[model samples]
Target: MHLREVRSNQFKLLLIALLIILCMALAYRLLIVRKNLKIAQQADELQEQKSHLLEQQMALDSLSRQLKVAQQDNQEELRQKQSEYNQKAQEVELLKQQYIQQRQYLLRESTIYKKIQKSVSTPNPDHKELLTDKDWKAIYKCIDTMYPSLSERLVLAGITPTEKKYCYLSFFQLDSKLEAFLLNVNIDTPYKNRTRIRQKLKITGSEEKLYEHLALWG
Candidate 1:
């Protein structure tokens, strides 16, 4: 009976040892599963970060392309403006040349201009003294009709009503100046020269003596 009881006790002890070993094996399996799940979660998070970085890189590339296109457009516009400015400058220069050519042509076509040019090139003292009595009458008529007050003033200054040939010659020259101006002849003589002549005549004290010695001409 004691031997049998001992065998039963040995069997119970073996069963308890097997149960403890099974529990240990299950705890080891749970630890391995938890470690594998943590590794999967970390991999997923890394993939998401990589995708975000790729999206940012694509956006930067798109913006860079747009900036390049904008720069090209601006350069084209600037070139167009420069071309237009050059064209306008050329047109203005052409207009200036045309106007100068037209003015030169008109001056060349003018009869009075030719006469004055001829007179300047070949001066003739005989032409100055070729005035006839009719020409003298016309000169006196112009003075009486156009410059009555100046004629009266000259007569009062004792420069008129004289038979001196130089005095009549001076009067004819003065009348010729008026005719040149009325005909729009572009002589270098300004009206100031006429004023100087009149003022000199007004200031002269002795007209007969002045005419005799050609002092007035001097």
Candidate 2:
């Protein structure tokens, strides 16, 4: 009976030991599974963060490229405008030079014209002289060649019926108070030819002094 009791107790203790070891093994397996699950979750979160960072970097690079293109376009426009301004400035300078040269030439011609008129005219004349048809023709030709701008304004240029020594040069005025005015010029010079009379011809008016006249034969 004693040996039988001891065998029974030993069997009970072995069964308890086996039960404890099985419970311990189950707990350890649960802990390892939870750890592995947590590690997997962390890896998923890290991948998500890397994807977000990559999207932000791509956006930044696209914006940088757009900015560079915009800057290049603006710079190109600025260069084109600067080139146009330089070309306009050069054109204005050329026109200024031409104007200066034209002014000087007009001034020199005016001085020479006045001197020739004073030298050719006689102070007083004794006899009444009438201009011949040939003389009138030559005078008209000389005036047309010398004063084209004045000729453009001229309506009529002929010997005055009332005054034979003087000619009535009717002109149409533009942008002036008077619409038209007649200018009187002496044409009684000894010089008969167009070349000689061209140097002596003088035109004078109450509104404007046009040219010098020839008055030797009046």
Q: Deviation in angstroms for 106 in model 2?
A: 98
Deviation from native of the Cα of residue 14 in model 2, angstroms: 0.8
The top-ranked prediction according to lDDT is: 1
Overall local distance difference test of candidate 2: 0.41
Lowest-lDDT window of 10 residues in candidate 2? 172-181
Q: Which segments of model 2 are wrong by more than 4 Å?
A: 73-218
Pairs of residues clashing in candidate 2: 188-217, 201-212, 201-213, 202-212, 202-213, 203-211
Please provide, for model 2 over 1-218, each residue's C-alpha lDDT reduced to its tens digit, 9 standing for 90 to 100: 99999999999999999999999999999988886576456445534544454465565555555555555678776565555555555655565455434333332333233332342343324333323355445444433333334333322333234322122221111111111111112342211222232333433343432232321111
Model 1 agreement with the true structure over 79-114: per-residue lDDT tens digits: 655555555556555654554343334334333334
- Give the Cα lDDT of each candidate: 0.47, 0.41
